[model samples]
Target: MPQEPVFHRYVALGDSFSEGVGDPDPTRPNGLRGWADRVAEELARRDADFGYANLAVRGRLLGPIVDEQLDAAIAMEPDLVTIYAGGNDLMRPRVDLDALAARYDEAIGKLTATGATVLMWTAFDAGWSAVFGKLRGRSAIYNELVREVADRHGATLVDFWRFGEYQDLRMWDWDRLHMSTPGHQNMAIRVLGTLGAPHRIEMDSLGPDLPTDKASRRRADLAWTKDFLVPWVGRRVRGSSSGDGVSAKRPTLAPIS
Candidate 1:
């Protein structure tokens, strides 16, 4: 059997997905304890020197994410790194996928050249969500680009685009944009498994089914549209972002405990 890999330092880069927006935890930084944090916590249990830093900020576009976080992550000299970007950019009315791919490829090349075990994720398939379904074709194209970049760089690929488990409504947060607690937990398990690392993390039970009645569903949808969708659209219109005044929750690597 192959020996399990050991990672002493781990750095996560990207936007809300990497930052853990949907998994709320008032006690943690940014009031969130996302999948990346969960992964770091588990890795910490396996190594005495494990340190982690997450530079992801919600609402950041691909350009700002790379400009702000890439060099900082490289400077940390982490043995393991995970990045999930471009989803925010895809949501825009227009995007130059070709140009975006070039930048993504370049960033991956730099991260890989550092000799770290880099992990990359394709955007999840959102065809089930009425709100995000429109971006399905664009997201698919970007996912393909991500695959090619990962192949060229030899980065571990976590194909989120194929996670059929996310088709379940419970796997998403109320906003329909980020993952729920169970979703984040599932991702942590996937990441560790890809690294060939043993972990005790398990998927949390989705205890009960949500109401399926048409009237009940309509009420819920209206509430979500009012509470989340409208504000999101307003932000786009105003050229603002949720992350505009937010700083990275974990800007430096330190022991998880």
Candidate 2:
């Protein structure tokens, strides 16, 4: 049997999801400790030599991600790299899927050429969100493209789209876009499993039930619309982004300590 993969240096690339938006952590560098951070911690536990760097920011588009992060990741000469982008691109009202996929394909080509074990993901299905419900189709398209790119380059594909575990309200945050803390933990577990890496990460349970009844759900939806949706739309309208001046959490590879 083939030996399990062990990476010395790992880099995670993408946007808010990788940045750990919903999984808030006041102690971490970005005031959030996301799945990538958890994955890095687990990897470090498995090997004391492991070093991790993440070049993810909130609300970043795929273009800047490729242009800004790809070169830096390549230069790191990491043993492993995970690329999770295109979901943000899908959120736009109109996008040329073909063009976006082509760019993504080019990126994968470059990353694979670094001789690293590249990993990519299919977007998770956020079950029934009144806010982002319609964008699911676009997300699906991006997921398919991700799968195709991963296969073509022999990269590990973390296929979240088919994972039924994410099809629950507990897996999402109030924004209905990013994953909740439990969701991030579950994702770390899934990533370790996919990579055949040893990890102590485990998901105990979904915790508690969110308000799901009609009246409560209505109030939650209104709150979501007001707090998250309006600001998001306003940002788009003004030709701005949530990551306007935000910097990457981990721009260089180093031991997690």
Task: List RMSD in Å for every model shown.
Answer: 0.9, 1.4
Question: lDDT score of model 1?
Answer: 0.93
User: Model 1, range 1-257, lDDT digits (tens) per residue?
Assistant: 99988899999999999999899999998999989999998889889989999999999999998999999999999999999999999999999999999999999999999999999999999998887999999999999999999999898899998889999989988888899999999999989888898888878897699899999999999999999999999999999999999999999999885
Give the runs in model 2 whose Cα sits over 4 Å from its true position: none
TM-score to native of every candidate shown: 0.98, 0.95
For lDDT, the strongest prediction is 1
Clashing pairs in 2: none
Candidate 1 Cα deviation (angstroms), residue 31? 1.2
The sequence of per-residue lDDT tens digits that candidate 2 reaches over residues 91-135 is 788999889989999999999988998888887775466557677
